[model samples]
Target: MGKENSSVLPVLQWLNRVVSEPHYLLHFLTFFSYFVIRCSATHILAPHLIHHLLQREIQTLLVFAVLALIKGVREETWEAFIADALFLAKICIFVLAFTMDRRLAIWYVLVFLVMHMLTQQPPFQGLGTSSKLTPLQLESLLTEGNTTRLWLVEFCASYSSGCIRSSQQFPELSITYSSKILSFGIVDLGLFPNAAEKFGISLSGCMGQLPTYILFDNATEVARFPELDFETTFFHPTVTKGLLSRHFDLDRSLLEYFNVK
Candidate 1:
């Protein structure tokens, strides 16, 4: 039992590290191996079976083409279908690469950027910056210490996607509410291990999970949100506002501020 546990522990730790940080080389090698295996499968398959499969797929395409022509498909409809087909093809490529070789998929995706870059533009320009808080600063703002009525502090890391998303929202949130009513602070866990340790937050546990939001009402924790919640809610202003509003008695005026009816 001890031997088995010891063997599994190292593998688990290795997996934890690999998942916690991005490794392009690891992804590339994995994908390349899968790609080679897939290529080898073609050589192993009987030529007769491959030919039969190709014929069947061609027939299916012809049937779809005929049906489209009979339906009087407009130019726009054809364009839309073509766009969807291209998107599906791209997804198939990404899936193949992601499953076997992720590094290639990440690079190959640049091919589609031309289309997206030509079509889309960013919606928001970002509002401003969130305040930075150190251990002493944070301790001073706790419930027992002199602090505002409501405070929200984000324990974040530079590498965390959720943290970056939350940071984008922080500027807007702080700007709308102002520091008097509701304030925002950020403590980078990587830079300040003591802060994370002092707050009983495990850095290893926080590797892939970050942007832990702790809402304090004069130092007493009113509400806390974990990484999973941020993953789902960070991108949606309405959903995020709803969560905060319910727990923190956030002003209804924020709805107007965000143009959410």
Candidate 2:
């Protein structure tokens, strides 16, 4: 058990580093490997299987085309759910490509590269920055000297579609409501999965809960959103800026911050 954990830690750490900070050398290696993969696939698959794989790629493109058409039908109609769907579709395509066919996987990488260059935005990379908290900083602030303040910390993973959907909302809340007495922060579960164990969050995909919002008062968790529902089994009402405000009473917190003397 000790050896198993010892081996897993480095792999998770490396992934955290890559996602938090891009390494150009890794990109270069991946790019060079693309051609090698293409050559290998060319020899590995027969003519019929190659045709079938090509069809699969085309079907994937067609699905995106339909989604694009829907979004293009109206300019203002674009919503978070649509973006979420597109993101999830991209993830599905990514996983299926790697599992079903190598050449298709390389094809996705190429297309994603071009798309990323065009948009200057990539998936798995979060939208904006926030009052990000490391585990140590969080512990010190919550448990150490100061015991009068209130903190609303969002525990989230960068890779979670839910987190990506609500990324901008938390920062905007922090800007509008954050003061000396009350603060807003973000702890990326993707970067520090170890924090999940400490915070009592499950990293399992089956849980379907990545972005958990907790309101901490004087080192204790006073309130939380999407409070576990055993009947339905997940946090409901969908996380939004409005939801956060109401769930934690941000207006009251703001008023209290001003009243602090």
- Estimate the Cα RMSD of every predicted model relative to the unseen true structure: 17.0, 12.3
Worst 10 residues of 1 by lDDT: 74-83
Residue 198 in candidate 2, Cα distance off native in Å? 1.9
On a 0 to 100 scale, what is the lDDT of residue 247 in model 1?
51
Report lDDT per candidate.
0.54, 0.67
Best-fitting candidate, scored by lDDT = 2
Give residue 33's lDDT in candidate 2 (0 to 100): 55
lDDT of 1 by residue, 1-261 (tens): 999998688457545544443342244344355456557746765887556645644564565566555443532222233333434445555655444446766765764464344432111234454577786877776644445566777787654434543445555566656544466777788788777766655566334446567777677777766434546443433214345555555574344335633
Native-referenced Cα lDDT, model 2: 0.67
- Alpha carbon RMSD to native, model 2: 12.3
Cα lDDT tens digits for candidate 2, 1-261: 999998688467545554554432344344455456656777787888777767766776677677767654532212344454446465556755675576777787787676555432223333233468898889888886654388889898866656655566677677778777787778888899999998877777557666788898888998886576654235365566777899889899888777774
**Candidate 1 lDDT (Cα, 0 to 1):** 0.54
Counting clashing residue pairs in each candidate, in order, gives: 6, 0
